[model samples]
Target: MKRNYMYIVLAYGLFLGWLLSFPYNGPVLKHLVLIHQVPIASFSLVYTVVPAVFLIIYLLFFQIKEEYAKNIMNWSITACIVGTVILFTLPTYYWYPVLAVMGIGSVMYIIGWSYYYTMEIPIDEKMRIMALVIIIGNSIYYVINILHDQISIGFLLAVIIVPLIGAFRATSNIAVNNKIAVELEHEPLPVKLIFVICSFLFAVNITDGLTFHAIYPSFDQLFVEYFTFYGIMPYIITLVIIFFFGTKLSIMFPVFLGTSVLGLAYLSFGLMGKNWYSYFITETFLQMGWALLDLVLWTLFGLIASIYGRPLKICGYAFLANLLAVFAGGLLAVRILNKLDNYFIISAAFAIGIIFISFLIVPWLSEAIEKDLRNKLFKTNLQNKPIEEISPLSIPLPQREILTPREREIAELLIQGFTNKQIADLLHISENTIKTHTRKIYSKLDVANKRELLQLSFSSRMSKGRSS
Candidate 1:
């Protein structure tokens, strides 16, 4: 894929975040509810339930046809436009059904584009792409929230239409590659691991729902008072952390830490009683924790989809888990907690309790799952076999003197299946430097590619073992 094509993928990410931040989950929902005098409970239910049902249906039954994916995507965009228009102009009675149709369109839109992404992009590239997407997408969301007062219906329509145009152009330019499918057949889906992680996400996000309600009792407060400092800054910081350290750190570390931070944030809210100073401190931590967890959840799903080569299935189920948890927590907060006294205290206790449970379980799950994925991805099963049995004398090994120490190190990493980018990151060098060394290593070893280099290395090692 062209580098420019990867940049274009950002349009889809921006669109997703923009939609969620505005018309779906954020300010627009509040705007509509307040203006049309729709009950919050009924509005929340229709918004959450309709899309969630569509996501679940897609997860269970829908499959995107690769050939017709572009058409599906274009049509889904049209549905979204029509749905938005109807939503803005129509009577309250017509809202629920239109929302349902829009929800289906959203699901189709996501699944269709995601299928192309998973098929065309390699896993490593997917990680970089997703990280960039989250960073820029959320930044755009924050900017919109900041300027919400200035935002007109025309502005909203422009946001949708601009990205839609870009997305259509990008999808047209995407080059199809089926090489990943062959690898997918060899690797088994880590079904149990995925389920457990999804369950953890569901549980954690329920606390988010509770705390979200506890922190901002009114949506107007979210817009006018809180989101400016407490919301945008911490989230931006979190995105930066994910962008820089995400690949280097284990997923469990951030998750555990995020949950702990959130627990403490809520605990502070209960103990400190929403004083300005206290609110600032707690809400900053709260946004950081929430942003961290949300980004990690999507990153985890993207990683799974990359490995499994079924983007729709993996991402759809992930979306379902996350959406349901948020919905359930939101519903619980609205219906039950609003009636209860000391709701902040109740929410804090629940969040802190989940932290304890996560602390106990996340380590074991992370270790086991990471180990399995690493072993499978790196072909570490060869370690269990005899050297002679696994290594064939298909390629001649070059003399050790032909390579410099740096070249040797680079070659070793290549044989171990590290990409140039990974090797550069590991060695604290520029990728261009790594590329230079890789070229020298390839030339010295008389190999055109990593596969040949691997064959040569294996044969050399096996020969040495026999001689010794």
Candidate 2:
């Protein structure tokens, strides 16, 4: 549509505007670290606190599904403006709180912007656009910082351009009035999936946070250069790699690959100390891998939103899980970073152990969840009927007599081994609605789960045969 094209233009303009307005994070961090003598641990406040605030906002306002997108955007803009003002003034009194608020605003804006694109744009196109945005943003930011020692020029441009970017119309994809009227509890987020995602995130982020805190401040200029180059080089290269190899593969393929790179980066830092190449590897490859993993994680959460029928809720939970782990990891790093004697060796060993656990837990957890769901479904069926023997002819008897026509249709699919998700898709309804109907079908048939319903159908057919 013309609307989508307009949005694509706006997205590009927004990134350009953002970069022009706020050059690079390097200068801000440098100002805080050098001028204010702010502890590296203090910077963790932003990552830790902002998502919690957003989570609260998500719970309070977004739950109603009324003007969700607009509200999020407004909050983000306000926060960013406030953050920038405080930073520009270079206030000494309330340093942490001011920076934290700014971080909140900026991060919220980013979250809202990302959510909009994911909802509105197709995946392949979205990936390319995002890559371009990063490449351009970082290139502009670093170029400006490298060219001029004074930050005044960037600030002046930002003052002129940010408002123009703000005035552009942003499209909202969330329906103002939700038709299904499903309650929050019916969202059907699997526990095992949450565990797997949260655990993996925690492991990766903890390693990064600890190593970053350990090594970053020691070589500040090198750290900034490394990330600047990382942003320019790897962003493009990874996108190209993914464009070719990533098309046919599962998102998890990149995730696993990223995890490997991340672990290696950690190991290199642990063993190699503060060498320039180590910095390059850590900043470029490790970050590239992180970006890949991050892309998939957000995309998966978007899929979860579609699957569950509560976009805001599912996204919020995913965000909360990710941010919570990141915050905890940062805090832990702050504590142990100073305490460890041979920090590199211990950290490398820790990362390896965690990665090993990740491999064991993720797949096993997935299988365990599937097996558990099946077992729960099978409990009501005391008699074992061969699954295939439950036939079309058997459909008219017992539970079929009790179920509504639509429920019967769903029951037939269940007997045919269609998953709830598959049934939802085929029926062109939300998965939550499918689950609601499934529960109703179970209740009507005096059955606990899918296996029992099929058994009743089969048993009814056997009884009919005996009577005949």
Candidate 3:
């Protein structure tokens, strides 16, 4: 709650702005290939290798820092600029690899910024913010694509430029973690959940890979049509569900159910059905299912990072896992594309198995996570209580300048690193009210972040004691 919600909104808005600024090739790749006389293989090579490079670099060297989010946002903007220049100016296929590498960089920034922003928010706001960002960001993406041919090159450039300027301001205002607040032990992993999640992701990724490649060859014309008609459908439905029924249901329910639908949809698509109506039905389910899965999966990843207090480690691993799953799926799909009967049979069985397993896995994982979080809280409370003979009550107070009683109370709790939600619970106030109090405290004290406030308060107290 120490964070301003407006900042969160702005940060996310900038991310979307940066994302949509990159020219979408899905609708134009064929034209670019045929008209520009560029080899299709170059594009294929780029699409294949970019993810590999991204995963390798991330695993080898990406580390979390205080300015991690801001830095990533900057990198994304840089990459977008580079990619835009190359795509518009260069017609040669030779530059495809270079553009691909830049694209990879932009994608990594997307993931990195998402991790950084989501971890700071309270769990209560995580789902809503995640949904809102996706819905809005993707809407911009689709709208840009829909107008791709109709708009002028200069106008497109302006679209890229305007949001970016605002994004820069928003990103700069974001807080950085100059120090590591918590150290996490990586041993004693949650074996069951990890196993299930990995297996499920692998299976789903394979189906997704197969479906896309298989469908695109026969239905290339439908890409833009599908995007036009149903691009925002899933996101809208997701927003409604989250807005209307978020409190009544656990996220695990939608996650499992959506995944199950996705599996079935993939199975249908793999069977080589020629009926246009069936394709429409399959795609409709695919969009909705994927929307829910994306929302829940990324939110879960961010939550894990927050809970473990190791944002980079958790998110990096998740990204790596996704990369591997997608890569393997693509390879398998390529191998089986000629054998439609076998592909259909195998994909259908995999889908059915995943759906059944999901029922058992999702509920168990949710319960385990809740139980573990409770245990951690209990242990933390015990550790916070001083065990020495001296009581906390005997300690001298910080000699700060005049503060409202409410502000003083908030400062003390903030010093203890209690989240906004925790403070709201303790004070029986709304989290929004807590945020307002925090903003006022920071303004009065001229501090930007919690660490600064704590330092200022303690230093003043120490100076007063020395003089006395």
Best candidate per TM-score, number?
1
* Cα lDDT tens digits for candidate 3, 199-261: 656655555555656654545464546656665576567665775665566768778878878
What does each candidate score in C-alpha RMSD? 11.3, 8.7, 13.9
> Can you tell me which runs of candidate 1 are displaced by over 4 Å?
1-8, 61-71, 116-128, 186-188, 218-223, 379-468
Q: Flag regions of model 3 displaced more than 4 Å.
A: 1-3, 9-25, 28-35, 39-41, 44-48, 60-62, 160-166, 176-199, 216-227, 267-272, 338-346, 379-468
Local distance difference test scores for all models = 0.69, 0.57, 0.63
Evaluate residue 297 in candidate 3 and report its C-alpha lDDT on the 0 to 100 scale: 74
Clashes of 2: 0
Scored by lDDT, the top model is 1
Question: Which lDDT tens digits does candidate 1 get at residues 1-468?
Answer: 476447446647656665655556666656666778877556556666888887776667776545576677778777777777777678888877777777667766766677666666554555445656667767776766666555776576565455555655665665555554444532566788789778988988887677666566533343446655456678678767776766676666778878888888878877887566666778777878877777666667766666555666676777678779988888789788878887877877887888888888788777865776675566534433443343212233558678887777777766766667667766779999998988888887788988888888888988977889
Which order, best to worst by lDDT?
1, 3, 2
The weakest ten consecutive residues by lDDT in model 1 span: 387-396
TM-scores, all candidates, are 0.74, 0.67, 0.70
What value does the lDDT take at residue 325 in candidate 1? 91
lDDT (0-100) at residue 442 of candidate 3? 88
